[model samples]
Target: MPTPVILEDLQAAFPGWCIWRSSAGRLWATRNGRHLSQHEVDHGLCRTIDADDVAQLAEQLKEQETAEQAL
Candidate 1:
């Protein structure tokens, strides 16, 4: 799949996140509205997550989703 399609899929898969690619080609995602708390951050949540490719970004997003659910 193409980058744009992958980005769209990611955006759809993680509705609470805004996903995009930088000019330098790094994939990034940030939460749409609410911010993570310090406790969440300390427990491994992040304000923003970046990955070199779609798969890694997806995996990270899934992990974040799990972390959010655990809260």
Candidate 2:
């Protein structure tokens, strides 16, 4: 299957803690896609990222559109 989100991306999505691949091989995020792993957060393995982080990521992605437009 195609990998939608990876470990490093998850960490960036939820900064301030470490994030690694779970044996389950699925995204550590929620069904609603709000936060990362809950259990891990409690254990200090990771933390839930704020919505602002996602917005910044979206802005960064605009670079791709700009580049495509130039091309």
Candidate 3:
């Protein structure tokens, strides 16, 4: 499972997505109001990543959110 800090950061960054870990220790995500699976995100969106990459994504998302809010 991801640490609390990483989990909180991701949740805040991706408010419209569901991010979680599976029992097998794999990360998964699904957009809110969508029936997409982790596999779909990986193959279709080409967003397969590890924990470190997730942190980077969180930072990017945070910046985008901030910019959107400022506009």
Candidate 4:
């Protein structure tokens, strides 16, 4: 699939996050408005996540979701 389509799907799947591919082709995601607390950060949450491809990005997003739910 094309990058735009992938990005659109990712955006829909993870609405709280802004997803896009950089000019250098690295996929990046950042929270739309929600900020992580210090505890969340200590538990492995990040303000932004980057990956080389969609699968990795999705995995990271899932991990973030899990971490958020755990809190």
lDDT of each: 0.87, 0.37, 0.54, 0.86
**Candidate 4 lDDT tens digits, 1-71:** 32333777888888999998899999999999988889999998889999999888988898899988888
* Model 2, span 1-71: residue lDDT tens: 12224446544543434433346543233223336455544444223222224334333333323433444
Using lDDT, rank the candidates from best to worst: 1, 4, 3, 2
RMSD of each: 3.3, 14.1, 7.7, 3.5
Report the number of the highest-lDDT candidate.
1
Weakest ten-residue segment in model 3 by summed lDDT: 43-52
Worst 10 residues of 2 by lDDT: 45-54
Per-candidate clash tally: 0, 0, 0, 0
For candidate 1, the lDDT comes to 0.87
The per-residue C-alpha lDDT of model 3 at residue 19 equals 76
The ten-residue window of minimal lDDT in model 1 covers 1-10
Could you tell me every candidate's TM-score relative to the true structure?
0.89, 0.26, 0.44, 0.88
